[model samples]
Target: MAVQSLQAAPVPVTAAGRRRDREAMIAFWLFMSPMLLGLIVFTFVPIVWGFLLSFSRAQNTVSVGDFIGFQNYVDVLRDREFRRSLITILVFTAFIVPLTYAASLGLAMLVNGVNWGRGIFRTAFFIPTAISYVVASLIWRMSLFNGIPSGVANIAIYEWFGIENPINWIAGTDPPWYWLVLVTVRLWLQVGFYMIIFIAGLQEIPRSLYEAAWVDGARSGWTTFRDITLPMLRNTTIAVMLLLFINAFQAFDEFFNVLGGTAATQGNRGLARPPLVYLYQVAFQDADYGRGSAGAFILTAIIITVTVVQGRLFGFGRSA
Candidate 1:
């Protein structure tokens, strides 16, 4: 009888197994209920709504309006100001990304060397990042580079070389001066963040690699960096570049607060106005919601495209 029982076919328990799976699934859903609900209510819903609104001519006061089809996109693309804004944003990103990356790398290398007071130096470097962009903008506009003799720049210039005229750093009509000022401010505000990233990357690198390089008669700093440091920091460099590019594209508070607008400056274009600021003026000041939404979508597309291109160029996200 025991042999017969052993040889007997197993009783069908597929239904029981199915029931157990159902119960597990129910429990999982219950556990994930809150997050799922939040995603539906906050993220998915808003994205769907915004996408819908992009096709419609909705005023800021009201949520719904007449469907406008491709008119908004057509208008934005046709507008000269929008084109100019896009160019301006591209230029800003181009200038700031390289400058920020270079400065951050330099600062990271410097701070990574110092054994004494390294913590203090690191904290000081990163303190500006802790401040809000608006606060930093205001401080720079009023105190540091205030385009006056009493400003810090002026004081430095005077103290160092006894220069008579304090240069108006922010009030230049030419592209070069404006570009310089914009890059300087952006570098000052952002270098610390990238420096921290680079520092973290630097720390992750194995000391053994450096020792091995030294053992191989790599005495030059440049050789060590090229062979040891750069290869190890490839990922960090890509990350910093991506972030810097995005931030440069979205720059608004500094440009808006520091230079005001072309209207306020009496047709004096302040170096350049980025796409976000241009969209703001179009949407709020000019009451052109459709065009603004179109411009925003285009800007988003540009950012995505540029990021993808950069990733491809640098081979980011590949197995290191």
Candidate 2:
């Protein structure tokens, strides 16, 4: 009886089960078809085409047969405007990334500490992130800092502070108040998003750890935060910093709109322009697809390098 039980027969495949499995696979493929099709057409095709086009001298059109080895790359690198744009982005990223990280972490801690209305606070802060950059830029430029005495910012400055002259926030280069506008708008849009991320990270921390720390004579505020909270949040901090750096590098819409769109190209073209805007002028406006494509790859290489270096610095993929 023991031997017979040990050699029990295997269950047979049921016809209904087989049919259901096949139907499920078919449904999955059917559901995924649109996304797969779109990815291939929009993303994969462009990436491959742009790569090939970058190696060619395909000016005025992307029909790619001219085949210039590395001249396009050399030209892009040598162009002074392109170099200036790189510096502009570097500065912008330097300023925004740290500010965003600090603000996000601070807001996250504040929201996490609250005993009530947490959802409302989270929603209020995060709603700005959903707003279009162009729309926000318009609001900042037209309504808030319109360079007129009647503008909200100008009114505050003139009425409250007793300043005789209204500051031309965007157009003026003397003080470069434009950076203030750029940084503030970007900060307002992004801080909430990162705050939510930090909040999630904060929640993941075990309450037992904090209780233990408290019993061990760790103070409730800065001492506990510095020793326990920050160390516990290392992974989340690394992720947030990585994302912040990427977003800062991709800054374009705000700079373009707030700086005056095509009018930006008219005077002081070198001021406040980032790589994307410069690449746009090259590829779309100037019809130099080859150089534009090369410039894009160059920027991609820079971003990849920075991300890798950052990951290494933070021990991102390392085991604890």
Candidate 3:
């Protein structure tokens, strides 16, 4: 009998290999440099500068004078408009997040179940996401939700249903009718994107689990989905919710385009103006850079805090 001894051979690195590796690293970095540079220049620098401006007294946003040290923040926090705008955003987020989430999840489920033309349906739904917010808002305002009886919404309510008057969907704040417009536009523009995310998450779930459930007489689709699909999609759901919350908070273009008009009077501005709209008026209209910057930071903090709380509650990235 013979015993064999095994020796591990080391991987050989030639001089040419080392040179190629170095060159590859250099080339990779070269490819990345433009994007890295753009991020630093456009995103990072603006964020840092905005933070600094928040603490300073800048009238025109250009000449930063005297570090007033939180005066701007205090002023912004105490401002009625700022407080009101933030509150409005909170209310909007409360509604839009849930509605969008449910709608997207339902749409994803429907799209996932389709045996044919899945891509066509997904692309059809996702087409709205590509539409510019301004254009969508304009279409919603001018064509769909227009105050006149000729508008689609008014026609449905007033003509088809035989209501006496055409309700002003955006302008009427008596029952907060404007919320209907806001919520609908947001759902139309965003649900498709989130639906795609949900679809991706749904696809990752194994078919074997569903089959096993079916074998166990969990043949009811709703039962299987509730017991299996939702639980499996927990992290994905959390991510979608977080993103929805952020998007809701950052709502500006639609609100601005719909509500903000040529007349910049306080009377013209309605109740649904979000924080960004308020900040926009402050910075651009009133030329209050310091306050605007403070408002920006305050909104950012609110977004981060909400996200962290949600992540904690949902046990995101945590094992079962």
Candidate 4:
């Protein structure tokens, strides 16, 4: 009887221990309830719904509709306009990412070199980042590249270079050149944001490394940059590249505002039309919800794939 009692005593204790752990877990879950609820409502719910919607024919007004299997995706694949838009988006990303990185790195270097008013310089560079995409697009359209003699670019061209006529930088369909204008405006708008990122990355880098490089007699700019700055900035560089690529691919506002939605300008000739814009046209303008949803999903897939590829190629988050 004594042995039986002792053996039975541990069972109750173990049961009590398990109950205590269960209660603690319940409390922890309660603590996290609000955040979990918010994530479900805002993020997870939307993502799941969007994915489901991609397979259906639901419009913005209608919540649910007939399931169309792979018809939506098939239509998108066969769509020439959608294909063109995808290519345009890719081209835009290709141009903007490298340009943004180079410009941001240069701006960061410039700010870092300054002995006084570094804050002011940093703020000035970041001011554009504070502006919304719509506001910035409007500003660029009206004030900077307005395409008239009174416009900034035109005025500068006429006064400084003595060119008679102001060129319509955004209106022309000339292959590479119109693309250049779009890319330049995008670069001007985006460089500041990336500059801030680069500045932060640069600041985090230890001064000891540079001191060591100096001690090693690495006085040349190329050698020091290649050996010290580039290696140290690898993670930051990957982040900047990813951000620039995503922003470039998802670009819509500037293109939409600058290149208004006339059918003539909808094709490859127009600078403003990216995949998102085309998707917007199909979903909103034409009311082809199924096709639009498919395009959106395809675009999302492309972004995910490209980001993964970039991560693999650049080894992001793998090292310090």
Candidate with top lDDT is 2
Off by over 4 Å in 1: 1-39, 59-62, 261-270
Q: What lDDT tens digits, residue by residue, belong to model 1 across residues 1-320? A: 88887795864679897897789999999999999999999988876666666778866632746888988888888988878888888788777888888888999999998999999989999987877777776677678877789999889999999997887777755434556656677688888988999999999999999898788888849998998899999999988888888888888877876665446552435357778888888778787676677778888899899899989999989978
lDDT of 3 by residue, 1-320 (tens): 13333554453699987897899999999999999999999999989888888888888764566689999999998988888998899899989999999999999999999999999999999999999999999898889988897989988886668896888887777887878888899899989999999999999999999999989989857898899999999889988988888889999988887775555545536578899989988888889888899899999899899889988998877975
Which candidate, 3 or 4, would have the higher lDDT against the true structure? 3
**Candidates arranged by lDDT, highest first:** 2, 3, 1, 4
Q: Over 4 Å off in model 2, which ranges?
A: 1-21, 263-265
Better of 2 and 4 by lDDT: 2
Query: Could you tell me every candidate's TM-score relative to the true structure?
Result: 0.84, 0.92, 0.92, 0.84
**Residue-level lDDT tens digits of model 4 in 1-320:** 87786773443558789998799999999999999999999989877776777788876544646898988899888988788888888878878887788998999989988999999998888887767777766677678877788988889889899998878767765533456557777787778888888888888888898888888888848898888888888998999888888888888887886675456545533454788888888888788777787888899999999999999999987966
lDDT of each: 0.80, 0.92, 0.87, 0.80
The residue pairs in collision within model 2 are none
| Worst ten in a row by lDDT for model 4 | 261-270
Per-residue error (Å), model 2, residue 161:
2.4
Residue 276's C-alpha lDDT in candidate 4? Answer: 85
Model 3 vs. true fold: TM: 0.92
In terms of lDDT, model 1 sits at 0.80
Candidate 2 has its poorest 10 consecutive residues by lDDT at 262-271
